[model samples]
Target chain A: MFYLLGLGILCIAFLFIIGLYNLDFKYLFMISAPAEKITAAVIIIGILNCIISILFFFGVGYLREAVKAFMEKKIFQLKTVLYFKRSGIYLSSCATLGFISRSLAIIYLRVDNNGSGFGLGYSSLLIFMLICGLCFILISHVLKESVALKEENDLTI
Target chain B: MSIYINLDKVLEDRDMKSHELAEKIGITRANLSILKTGKAKAVRFSTLEAICEVLDCQPGDILEYKAD
Candidate 1:
């Protein structure tokens, strides 16, 4: 039950990000810089967004495969383990890229860097992704043990 | 690990084949092979009973425990 709720929240956050992308962070920055800087910022942010989107989609694909394996009761197999582990790595990569890009953007845009940290909005999602990624890796380890036990049990007369 | 299967000895004594015992017990030949090779992790009571019934022997005659 809680797992479903968590996934729901993650999906909603993902949709919120898409909406934010559609809005295009132009207004989010209160900088009154020259046209050249503005164009450069747009290009940089666009490229970063593109990379992050690709990684996020790959992570989602791997997670969907893992979920399908669970639904089919094939969790005690190496294929399921591979799905979970790959998803975990992709998600962790997405979170890392998000953090690095956001931090660099903030520094480049000169957006009030008084040593304060990120806001509660997107940072929370990034943190959640990192945690979920680690959790998936852990679940994969547990499933590895389950696979061994299942093999042993099946061989038992 | 201390528990062992002595099914082969009893089968040889009765001049019975592994496939014959397996068919009698309604189990696959591969499963019976696992048992004969001493690779099975555990045995089911129903299967043990079936094997004993087919071989006309006691459970003790088929299983032996040796401390390692």
Candidate 2:
């Protein structure tokens, strides 16, 4: 629940930054500056960011449900496994979308002769997201094994 | 699937209730029910020993083999 609240705060802050402060992609999309380029690539990146945020939100919600089931001693149930699997997929989607968005941004910057400020930080962050996603998938497999073992134990008399 | 539990028959023959036998054997009613319903994957020898001791029956009398 705390994690959900934190994500909610983050999303609100992100929206405020984009709407009022006119952040990077938002400025590219909304500003009427003479030199501002409204390329299709930036629009795609914006869409990907929106998708990543929404996916994270839903994934967190599903995880909360899984935690609730765990507290109820339903750890080895099918629904728990499914919720983790879905969250894993959502995390992977976020990483993939971030990768595509960053790649497009790099290409756009290079084309516009503004490549001097491009850094490796965003790439490293995307890689971290990818690794986290793969770990979630691995955890789901472990949970599957646990479910099988639990069923066997339950049936043993 | 070939091995069959004769717990119900043995319990009936001894005029024993499921929960009563379960308590006498120091096992949970749910576990006893599982064994009686043949839903158990495998019965431990310790539990089998307890059941046989409490019900005054042999292991063979409680468990039987049936070719499927």
Top candidate, metric TM-score: 2
Tens digits of per-residue lDDT for model 2 on A40-115? 6666766776786787667657766776777788888889888878877886787788677667766864423222
Clashing pairs in 1: none
Off by over 4 Å in 1: A1-10, A13-16, A19-24, A27-35, A38-46, A111-120, B1-13, B23-27, B36-68
Scoring only the A-chain of each prediction against the true A-chain gives TM-scores of 0.74, 0.69
Predicted complex 1: DockQ: 0.68
User: Which residue pairs in model 2 clash with each other?
Assistant: none
Q: Estimate, for each residue in B1-68, the C-alpha lDDT of model 1 and write its tens digit.
A: 78888998999999999899999999999999998888898899999999999999999999999999
Q: Which residues of candidate 2, in runs, are more than 4 Å off?
A: A1-36, A70-74, A109-120
**Predicted complex 2: CAPRI docking category:** high
B1-68: candidate 2 lDDT, tens digit per residue: 88898988888999989989888878899988888888898888899889888989899998889988
